[model samples]
Target: MSGSEQAPVVGVSTYRQRAVTGVWDVEACLTPAPYVEGVTRAGGIAVLLPPQPADAAVAAAVLDRLDGLVLVGGSDVDPALYGAGPHDATDPPQRQRDTWEALLVHEAIARGVPFLGICRGAQVLGVALGGTLHQHVPEVIGHHGHRAGNAVFTPTVVTTVPGTRVADILGDGVTAPCYHHQAIDRVADGLVVGARDDDGLVEAVELPDHPFGVAVQWHPEEDLDDLRLFAALVDASARRRTGAYA
Candidate 1:
């Protein structure tokens, strides 16, 4: 492809936490390897967007430089943002990350940038748009299958809603690699459920009005063999870059 048609620049959100690298422990901004690999494998340039002090203006300025945005799974969002108290199982508040990500979600929607949220990323999208979370999936679903803990990922069967972008990409059903304990509850107003599990728990959501806006409770990046979701996001971004998406 020519420079004008080069792969789109896709920004993936990362975690800000302490790490021990080469006997040196320090705070760093990072995400799992799969996230960056997924984007590159799907024909997009990957850029990591770490937590930083940000406002709407900053968010817009950041979005102004990218063709697509991706919110990856990480620590739990503070329940306070959605007007609730913490659930014992919930991870302690990552306030800075929450604030920065929320801004990106809001601004990305307004700008109609292609977006894909994974695991906690899905929850972030919901809360950023006035929705809430179940806090603990096992408590609500009566099953511990959604998350098996100990850095283990449970295999989940997901059924996509017909006529939705997720369905168009993933077909009727897919077994996803999932490790989330908190699920979206009372989905955001403008966002529609795009897929669900047999238990009726929401597995995916999409903004119909946007060129491309989709989020899944499962960790698509974990399944490197299946890059369909990532490819779809990159495809939409490419279309947007070439003025082929309306």
Candidate 2:
């Protein structure tokens, strides 16, 4: 099979990580290896997109080449973007990454590219779509079950709405690894809630009219065993490349 017959290209955004590489301390663009592995396992070519200057042209250029986009999990979004003040528990914001990823999200949506947002990625999608966030889940939910601590993933049970894309993919009742402290507050107009937790917190969303746009508040990449979500994204990317949706 040729390149066109092979898996579609999926761009995964990365966060800035400070590291010591070969005795040189430097800031690096990085994401968990599983983000790449998950996409590959789902038969999609994974491309890591590091934080770039807040340039719409650059973002559009990147989106032009990608069949899909995966907004990987990372730091909290800057509250100012949604006209809110920061919460005490919210982590210090990564403004540069926020700007870059926000542009990518908007560009991908405008181009009708299939995209998946995980954790912070999901929050970014909501904000880009003219939505707001809860800022801190615990404050409203009255618990920290969503995020136990730093570097820890909690097992979460989410229920998908009937006849929705999430329910079609993962069924109604599904359990996945979750590590988030913020969630969608005021959902955007064109989007609809696709899944929720037992606490009634929004867990997933989908843009029904779009070719494929899903954002989940969990880390499916960490599941490793379940590639259904990634596979769905890859399939949608293939369809987009083939002009099946146009």
Candidate 3:
């Protein structure tokens, strides 16, 4: 295939796991299969990026080879990263994943790479950009509608802000599969709210100056029917790879 026709490489962040798969319990780097499926379905080369050393150089090297990034959903962000104390409902933070993904977020921003962050990944993007999180959505909303239970994907109606990229892509009044317990509290500088739920909770955000930097509180990967978000990232990556952004 010609260089311009090559599929854009999209890197996806993974979760570290300790699982018993057979006779032995082992530590492993893993990501949800749906994330890969979504990226591949969007015509991009999906590359799993497991957590690495918390070094800027390493993160930069990894980003240098990719055209786009997907920060997959996982554990809660460490409150300390946003200068807040953890709430009782907050899950124990995954410090290692936190450190590594934070580096990736920084590098991706510095390099102007297109990225999509889902759930916890969205929180990471927010914190990395000097934003704070709600810590516990139940406390603010007084309901667990956003996350009915563990391993459950609750459906919620989210309205996109008119004229925002999210509205342009998903249109207004979108019913999305959501399973998040925390939400952005203080939106970061330069990032604008792209969508929100009926409760007026922030559901999505975008960086106006970025080529394609969007993060959503819902798990788009769980919604197999809609590949628009993933496709947007891939399209942005393809543009970057072919100098369309120039």
> Using alpha carbons, what is the TM-score of model 1?
0.97
Winner by TM-score = 1
In terms of TM-score, how similar is model 3 to the real structure?
A: 0.96
Stretches of model 2 off by over 4 angstroms after superposition: 1-5
> lDDT scores for all predictions?
0.93, 0.90, 0.90
State the lDDT of candidate 3 residue by residue for 56-88, as single tens digits: 999999998999999999888999999988898
If scored against the real structure, what TM-score would every candidate get? 0.97, 0.96, 0.96
Off by over 4 Å in 1: 1-5
Residue 127 Cα positional deviation in candidate 3, in Å, after optimal superposition: 0.5
Model 3 lDDT, full chain set: 0.90
Model 2 lDDT, residue 214, Cα: 95
Instruction: Candidate 2: count the clashes.
Output: 0
